[model samples]
Target: MSRLVIAVFWLLHWLPLAVLAPLGQAFGLLLYVLVAPRRKVVLTNLRLCFPELSEGERRTLARRNFAITGRSMLERGLAWWAGPARLRAMVRIEGLERLNALKAAGRPVILLAPHFVGLDMAGTRLSMEGDFVSVYARQKDRVFDRWLYHGRSRFNDQLLLSRHDGVRATVKAMKAGRPFYYLPDLDYGRKESIFVPFFGVPAATITGLPRLARLAGAAVVPCVTRILPGGAGYVLELGGPWADYPSDDVEADTRRMNAWLEEVIRTMPEQYYWVHRRFKTRPEGEPRIY
Candidate 1:
């Protein structure tokens, strides 16, 4: 199946360049709905995170999340061809000075961006505008992986690392003055994870954040990319370096960081990727809904 996905991408990659972006976007959204395994994961995550929501509310949020997920798949591809100058037009960026403050202080800025609306563009643009940064990611499939590499690094310097090398790569990048971007909210696996309070519930979170910051002296900055309804484009809001967070008690700080992330995500709950299996690896044998 993965090989077929690769073959399809290669076939399309050969098509006229003009059709790729939109075609990819359509493919992403359609796959989000039809992709059974990830679809179930997303649905479970949504139910666990937002139990207070009515069935109607859950359905609405799910629909919106899948749409954004699909669009993110496509928009990121367009970002490559869009170019920095043109992308700046598409995304009206603000709060750069805030990020620069950390750079000026000789502290690398570690952006704590949870998956929101326009993160693909947000991450891409930041590297273009600033000193360029590294971000944590699981290696993607070959066809898409090669495509994303060109697309993401088009105008920016993206030092992407695999999950295993996450700690070492981030530490080195920040120590050398490169700003780092990581998603602290998504659920990918159980290794190196510590359950932390998220949205008033304990969620398995990456424990490397505070330790990395303490080791490398990088400041954690929260960022969110929100695409407006009716296609008004996207807005990226940046939140600040949490002053004087402890080197120890990482679990506590991770919880606090995730709590802030949850708040940001909740403001636009419908846009959040709720279909993810955020609570997939719960501590107990059975998963609890919220």
Candidate 2:
């Protein structure tokens, strides 16, 4: 069934990306809404993250988030197959100049991009803005992993490092004065995290960004590309050149950075990619909400 789905995904993927962008997202949104188990995960995340919101608001957020996820998948298809230039028509982004400025500062700027919108294409565009390398994640199937790795790395010679080689590759590249982009969210089914205030709630988050930045004597920058309505492109918001990240207090830096990222996510709540169980990993005795 999974193989069949993947095969169908590949077959249908080529059509929308090549022809119609909005039509493509509509398909993805419908498909995900009808079939993905991740829907419940998104709803749970929304309710937990925004307790103060009324029930109707929570539902609205969930629907919006799902649409964003669909839009991201659609945009990625366009990015990989047809190229994401059309995606630029979807939303207006801010803070791009900040990235250019960071790159010129002589120190490699660590870009902390949240999973909101056209992150794939944004990474490529951001790379052109500066000397930046992004860590590529391993997808489920090895064949798919290789395929995705090549697609994302095609624009620039991004070192498609494996998870095991991530830190080594990043540190080496940073030493060479090249900036590295890494997603500091996601729970890898382990307790290797700190309870950080994300959306005013303690979301278990990876402290890798602050740790990596501190190691390279680099500055930490938060970037989020929001998915807008009507298949509008995206707005990539860049914030900060935070110094002394991941100080002696590991949890503090993690919390601070995560809070900043959460604010960025809040800017466009629906496109924030809430389907992933972000709080899957928790320390013993730490309250798990989702």
Candidate 3:
């Protein structure tokens, strides 16, 4: 089944953006209507994060978020199967100099990339520029796992280590001078997580970013990927490295990371990954939010 799905995606990779864009939106609308569970999750996340927006406004954003999510799903074909030249032509990157400067200075770098719909596109483009190591969750299906590993690692010098590899492995890679592509926003339960205010709500945020940066003596560079409307393509934005990150206070550093993420989401609320159960693991006595 996984092979067949990949085969279909590979075939769809040939479609021009003009055709795929609308098709993806239509499919997303259908999913919004049919996937009631995920739709509820999206709505729940939006409600929690954007209480200032009216219920109707949140609903509208939820629908558009699903649309972008679907488009990203279809566009993965481009990231996975398209030629480097083709992919490069579709991306407009900002702040390459920041990354280059870090590399030139031989500073260990960690890209604090949030969970955005265009994240894979950003990673694919960034891989072409320099080598980086990142942690990835494995798919349950073996065939899909193999496809994902190859698709992410096939271009440039990239290493997609399993999430189980933990901070030691990632820090080791970063200390070796390879940038770490870190996405530490999502909730992975309370084990190694600290409750940080994300959009003013206490969210179970990972402490890995500060821990890894401190361990590797890495500078934290913020990275964002925005999906262009009308299938125009994507923009990969890089911000300057944090001045005093991973300070003596790990929880404070985590809170700062979430604050930055909130600011970025305000710029493109619909593109944020709202379908995730971000607040799933609540405080011990708190009621469930989703």
Candidate 4:
């Protein structure tokens, strides 16, 4: 079954962007009507995060997000199997010098990536620049897992450590000069997470970013990927290296992280990943939002 799924995506890989673009939008609309559970999740997230938006406005954003999500799924073919020249042409990178400066200073860098629809585009495009390492939870299905791992690591000298490897392994890799491509936003429960204000909602955010950066003596550079409408392309934007981060207060750093992510989401409302149950873990005595 997994192989069949891969074969479908592989076949889609042969299609031109002009064809795939509108097809993805139409598929997304179909999915919005068909996938009730996920549609509820997306709307629930948007309502909690942006209470100021009118119900109609929020609904519009929800639909657009789904379309972008669908496009991202279909576009994975280009990211995974496309030629180097083709992939390079599809991506326009900004603030790359921020990362380059970190490398020049002999400082290990952590790419502070948030959960966005175009995240894969950012990682794969940047992989072409230099060797980098990222952490991912191993998927359950065996055949598809192998395919995913290979597809992501195939581009350049990229290394993907499983989440089971823990922070010690990540710190070691960063110290060894492999820039850590870190995705800081996600609901992983309250184990290593602290309740922080994400869009004024208390969200369970991982503190691994600050702790790992502090332990590895690395600099944190924010990276964002914006998906262009109608399958035009994507832009991988890098920000300046953070100074005074991972300070004596871990909670403060985590709060700052969430605040920064919220500001970015405002710029491109629909591009942010909204299907996630971001506010799933609530404060003590509080009810669940999803």
Candidate 2 clash total? Answer: 8
Candidate 2 global lDDT: 0.67
> Once model 3 is optimally superposed onto the true structure by TM-score, how far is the C-alpha of residue 214 displaced, in angstroms?
1.1
Which residue pairs clash in candidate 4?
none
Off by over 4 Å in 3: none
lDDT of 1 by residue, 1-290 (tens): 65575555445534433454445456656876687777666666776677898877876666667766666655554455565565675566667788887788787767877877578777777767755555544446766666567655666456767666757776887877787777767765577788777766667788767877787777887778887553455677777777886457887777777877777777887677665667766776755543
Please, what is the whole-model Cα lDDT of each candidate in the order they appear? 0.68, 0.67, 0.88, 0.86
- Quote the positional error of residue 126 for candidate 1 in Å: 1.2
lDDT of 3 by residue, 94-146 (tens): 99999999989989999989999989877888888878899878889998887
Give stretches of model 2 more than 4 Å off.
1-21, 83-94, 243-246, 285-290
**Sliding window of 10 residues with minimal summed lDDT for model 3:** 147-156
**What TM-score, to 2 decimals, does candidate 3 have?**
0.97
Q: lDDT of model 1 at residue 53? A: 83
Candidate 2, residues 1-290: lDDT per residue as tens digits? 54564465466555633344565556656855696577678777888888889888887677656555665664554444444454344334577667668666767777787776568767655544445677776888876665567556656556555667857778888777677777878776554667767776666677787678777877777777755455345566787677666688888888887777677666667777677888777667876655
**Full ranking by lDDT:** 3, 4, 1, 2
lDDT of 2 at 274: 76
Q: What is the Cα-based TM-score of model 2?
A: 0.82
Model 1 Cα shift for residue 66 (angstroms): 1.8
Could you tell me how far off, in angstroms, the CA of residue 262 lies in candidate 4 after the best superposition? 0.3
